[model samples]
Target: MAYDADTSIDLTQYRSLIDLIESSAKRYGDKTAYVCLGKATSFNEIERDSRYFAAYLQHHTELQVGDRIAIQLPNITQFVIAAYGAIRAGLVLVNTNPLYTERELIHQFNDSGAKALVVLSDLLPTLNNVVASTQLKTVITTHALDLIAPQPQSQCEFTTITFTKVLAEGSCLAFTPVSAKLEDLAALQYTGGTTGLSKGAMLSHRNLIANAMQIKSRLSDRLVQGEEIFVAPLPVYHIYAFMVNLVLYFERGGCSVLIPNPRDIASLIKTLSEHPFTGFAGLNTLFVGLCHQPEFKSLNFSHLKVTISGGTALTQAAANVWQATTGCTISEGYGLSETSPVVSLNAPGLEQLGTIGKPVIETQVKILDLNDQEVPPGETGELAVKGPQVMSGYWNKPQETAMVMTQDGYFKTGDIAIATEDGFHKIVDRKKDMIIVSGFNVYPNEVEEVLSAHKEILECAVIGVEHEHSGEAVKAVIVLSSLSQDLEQTKADILRYCREQLTAYKVPKIIEFMESLPKSTVGKILRRELRN
Candidate 1:
């Protein structure tokens, strides 16, 4: 079923991601596509640069058709180029967090078996420690100058180079053009597991393209092609922001105001004031942070048409505050890593407070009980989704893949929700023990498993706590068999170990000691009791 419109085309019909970028460039060549700092990048430049990067990859490196290429950069121009370059060069793209520790980086690099990596220069120290252990053969590094123009002084002291200089070291090899099908693998998005492991979700080109088109089609009414500006504060490595900010932005030829560091409210607010943004995509924490800042009240949001909230449940208080201040509600949505990150969203025009709107085009959503039977409307049950955006499966994990993927192709989202009579769905809670800190998933089991290895801890349980900015923060409750003289130092040591092992978001912000954790008669730890 192809959606027909005079100006809109089915984005999934394209064979490669580059095809959409190329077509949009031709249609809106002179229009600004992205803005950073004070400078703007036109669609023509984005197209030309991505093409050059693709040609460079084909010229250098043994990257062949269907090979996986890792992109480990921040929200910079090189990221977009490397992403489209690999896809156009017929290579599967592997998205990695730029702040990953050596252990985290090595796991994803080795698991994906990617042959090449494109990284930012300042993050080289982290990558340098791990690349030796992976099967990666080529490395491409970019400087800050590659993305933003020269600064008056070094606000950030990080080493990086242009892609031209990095590619000069290797001999260029012939790469196949866009010959892969839309159903072929395009990305391997690695998500943290329930069992304290990370597994890559294989998202095909069709999966991503379908999501982009579906989102674009829905927003097409209010969104004017080549005239709208999208605030991309969320990282593109995350699928929710990637589809809306990166993929859909390109599809509609809209300008993306890139926020390099969203954690810094001052800088993010400065960017918001610098541009005439029409659409803003972020989670609850970002909005809460914006409202907390003293200068936030003065920021102009009259041009803004929509605010998309995902990555976690948005509270009624946060939504009400944003609406009162900006005259626009933060539209909440629901998804998981396996569903290309977006299965349902509250359409901008039909947004309902506290609900993750309706299902997008060509998508089916259902609420099922423990017996897989459909639950009545307004009844709490597990949310299951079937759509083109659903991932193929977990990479190389058939047993794990079969566990989540239903026989009829629906992906179990592991989120407890209820559909209202009006067709809007609200998330009651998560069935999995995953903590969302500042819109990033922090698996408590993984944190607890790491804390248990501490010499001072006999057993530990990690849970989420109400946070002002992060929405939810990791808190560790531990049982110590032996009491040490320096308990404070021991707690510090435990946190330090977790920082070294896990991502910063997964680290525990609060550490509390307990005699023993409440458990069921069968010896299963009661996480619900910990929440109380």
Candidate 2:
């Protein structure tokens, strides 16, 4: 099939995600769209369910168009329904992390001013505790098996409804169409803030649609619409997976096998064994972990064609192991939550092992020095991007948005990279202090804030250190309140406190107690000094 660069996949044809979904569902009605826990949902089924959920929002709730609704669930069939339904109803989707602590949850919900939330039943207790802190008017919950099988009725203290109940009730109600333009805000993808808070990246419909089209164009030669099956272990809430599996692949009429918990290597391997997946989306740590599993290595790789590596840098060791085990080369890409998550991806069979391949279609990448002047090719500098897929700005944060955007309209990526003479881009280092653990962003300020809040701790500093398993591990240097004879027990106490407050990955793996941390004249703890 000869792919047309201009008209093969026109992104401008769809104004919103609803338009995209409606067209795709109509085109591939009977094709399987998503599979989770042995239950497969066809394209038509996803469309119907998403419409029902949207109707429920329209009739059952007071939420107006463009209102933010938080979705905090793991990768499941319910997540897909909730996301598409929220977007279709003209609501701004807030992709919440399911593992967020109460403090993190409070900040995001309050910051986004989410009027509604669709969360997992398992996380109801956590939501219950924090519901009073937000402006949420409605709460809907669903279990992992809710779509697969019937569940017994359960009641909650707050006014909450079940996911099935919404679908049932909304099926009978009329779905009033909401006019969402391409320039309308679609999702508020929150990125880690250096100020110890998370800021939402305002992604418009055009931003998402354009990136999906850009990604589709890059992989058009390898991907067969309605024929490819993708193994999506990464959380759909993350932009990388959201754009690839949910938007791009979904529009391509591909089947996505959702692994709710990829951390469970045994279950992940078991899931992979059942499907002859042609595509896999993952990162360096996940790639290394899966390739190390003997059972994973034994799985059928005859059908696997493209395996994508993103979120963090792909090490040569991981790439070698994955190719040796699966017979599929890792196509590493680079992007941020601000860029609708994809600036460039490696061309499917012609992947350069270490570098994130050339910039995707309609995307411009430039390496600039401190003076904002473009550097010579092959020289290291800050990578700046300009494309239709770039986010408009941070949600409700003008000053922060101004800080990231250049006068000439490029978004500063904060990553140091070198554009090769061969057109490939290689990431040299991160200009920011953000730590990536298993492809999840972990900022030192957020972790340090939680640690310093402990009554037993006087002060602390956090930094990313190289690790064999996770690409980077959070390492903490602490200054104790007082001299303690039992330093080991004190360290244990501090870690226990962190576990209660911070997420699992943000908790420090290595803790070192010191009299004082290296600091500048202003008393700001030098994280780079700590890293060294």
Candidate 3:
């Protein structure tokens, strides 16, 4: 399908991401830019704080241009400050999840070669245990409400710097603006490695700027400069929310209400009640959970207009109930971590439920058979994409990158999709067996690796099972070396061990014991048989 005339946007307006941020701050200086914890931050304030942060990093820390700095934070005003500051200082941003376990943290920090990290104070205890293992030198910590309310803070047990101290000291130093090119490496977005360990997808400045423009063009009708307010319940650390809240919406002169904890449904509803929000961004689990709440059901959605669904598939039940409750239909979109994350999005009034809408502007999609040949329309095949929004390749893994990229330059999405006669596409299945729990990717290989480390487990395989709340959940089928009569205790003990090694979502919900798993002559476990 050709690019929709309605969603067409100029792709080359911004020279760099810094250009995008500074220009927007110039245009909407006094307007409200972000809201969190009952405090509103203005565009001018973001620009100023971020500038101070840049000056501090340049003078105080040994971090230089092109170095990597990780930001492990929730949706707060300080995240905006640290990200923009790091960008302005000519450093690459590594958006790390605060919920990451020590094992996961060690891999990402080491892989990215991150020398510095700005993290929430609550994560300090765990981080203190593993910071020495990585190449990290400077650690900056802050409370979630630290910037919102200037209170006396106790020093961290480990030697570290405070966020407020950086700002205060940076004010005395002079900041020299660093030159940036569109091709410069901006951020290292790590993907859930379905086949193995997660690898960083190097996103360039051009890729991010173009994606922001592409997504804005898709929502051209709904977004108004300086007039739109969006409630953001998604984690900003994820690329989906990162692109939307920090880049796309901020550049458009809009306000984003940041929700620190989305699992607290009552608090989220109460926060929604406080703002006459014009937009909301969420996925299936959030939509279903919110609609079932009595307080959410009774709230006034009179001003809500645009609701976006991404990060996972939108269920028919979720779509139906959301529209009935808010009188607004969700524009479900599709993308992967390798695509700057927005491949296609359904327009508000024209959304076709159960199908991802047309490809965004300047994006091309092809359905390919197992032989790498394009399949005829109305048939399911692996979806491949070519566009400005696609990442250059996997970071530092040239061979792995070459495997995914075709000779023709399209990136194989590893998803089974059907190209309809109408422009919209339906994702029927996945070519890779990757589980998505609560809109977060949970790869079986990673979980299996952790499980195999246990002394009791001889053989193990992980698979995704149907879950009503999270869309899909991780299930482990195992064969222990010795059969024990106390099955319940073994399960509980294994679960406890898993919680220590894996992130919350990656932990298997169900554990089933079997004599042996079905395997081929080559001795490879078949996850499909386990699923069956």
Candidate 4:
């Protein structure tokens, strides 16, 4: 395959993701592809296992081509196997958050109409309660250490199979080939919607393939194929990590060490000490958290060359601390799930500290004003994007898809940004009332909807408040059904109620009680007034 200088990608290289995977496996057969929990899987081994998984889906299940399969696992070896296998089996992948509540799970599963679920064994109990409510027909579960060590057999009420058993059974079946086109839907990536329900971004094989190529073009000079080792702590289910680790790094014949739980700084630092990692992908809060630890500062940084930040803004304090501690500079990028997650990234050695750097090759980015007209350079406006990597549209929701796209074919990102004369882009503000805490997006509507479900809550509004730790913290203004003299106890009770229904980041950090929430003439809660 030849690299195109004009478009920045060689479209003649491969047809689909399967083509890329098969070619890389053959090119780097004996090379280590992924390492997790002290176990390394080579490219050949990954190819074989994924083929066996595809065989199982073809012969055992009633699922047909184009059916959706939901994968609800964290960073693990099985996640890679299941995702690739699903694609190979001609099924669409739906990446599900493992931390999602039952209500969230129900909406995503039902909305996507996923026919099969590949999930962690620990989450099977949660799945058990919701599987009956979904369209799931086949359930495969695996332990975190299933690939590394043997586990005692556990019983379940549902008709479920263990991950190891599936692999063993699949090996007996003959694999069949299926034709998939670049325009075929590969995955349904769910993102927070303005209407309070999560919507699936219909990402095609071309979108994923194009984004991978664009990233490669941007960082080709720094990346050495078959030689680089990446420390992947961010969840692979997210599009940012998914494209960088599973797609780009895999295509480059590089090895990625997956961290199942990145919240454990002690464990993460210990893992870092064991490898001569050449690349690392993280965010602002993660960089700050790890750099502040003495154990992390003691690790060897001689082999570290690339440190990419995305999913949220990177603070200068975090960047400076990281550079001073590890002798490696942080390169921040910007994108959303709708764009296969990367629109622009700062190239190493030419990074601009607070800017997102230049747009990727073949991608068009513009700032548009309220009237959908292109804004002048240096003026803040809604950032819009047009590229092959952008999603076709939201799944099963044409109206919602039409709402985000303009007549000119650009996807309107609800973010305010300014383009510098030098071609760098800087984010100024967000057009939506969404809070980003530690790189995770927390939608106010979702939080407020969950909080309003509490029996004692009469009305509530959620707002983003500035925080020293997380970029923003969720704050709730509430008007109770009945006036309570014990305000402190009532606040505690409401918080306790929230933890059950919402994820930790989505839960409000501070709660204030008001006699009545401020409303507009139209009778809607004025969140801007609450923010003031």
Compose the digit string of candidate 2's lDDT tens values, residues 1-532.
3222434346668978889988898999999999998899999999999999999999989999989999999999999999999988999999999998888899999999999999888877777668998899999988889997757545566888999999999899989877778899999999998887899999999999999998888776678888999999999999988998889899899999999999899999999999999999888878888887889888989999888989888889889999999898988999999999888888877888888898888888888899889998668999999998999999899999998888999999889999878888999888669898988888888898899988778999999999888888999999989999999999899989898788788999999999988999998888888877
Candidate 1: tens digits of C-alpha lDDT, residues 135-240 = 8877777765665543222222233345755433322433345677777898999898998778999998788888877677655575777788998888888887
C-alpha lDDT of residue 247 in model 2: 93
Task: Give the clashing pairs for model 3.
Answer: none
Candidate 2 has what TM-score? 0.97
TM-score of each: 0.92, 0.97, 0.98, 0.97
What value of lDDT does candidate 3 attain over all alpha carbons? 0.90
**Tens-digit lDDT track of model 4 for 114-194:** 999998888776766788888999999889999887465455668888888889999999999878899999999999987
lDDT for 371 in candidate 3 is: 80
TM-score of 3: 0.98
lDDT of 4 at 357: 81
RMSD in angstroms, candidate 3?
1.6
Summarize candidate 3's per-residue lDDT along 1-532 as a digit string, tens digits: 2234354556567778998999999999999999999999999999999999999999989998999999999999999999999999999999998989999999999999999999988888888677889988899888888886765544455678889999999989899998899899999999888665889998999889888888877777688788899999998889999999999999999999999999899899999999999999998889988999989999999988899999888989999999999999999999987999999999778889998898899899999988888998788899999988899998889999998888899999999999888889999997568898988989899999999998889999999999888888899999998987898999998999999999999999999999999998999999987887
Residue 450, candidate 1: how far off, in angstroms? Answer: 1.6
How many backbone clashes are present in model 2? Answer: 0
For residue 41, give model 3's deviation from the true position in Å.
0.2
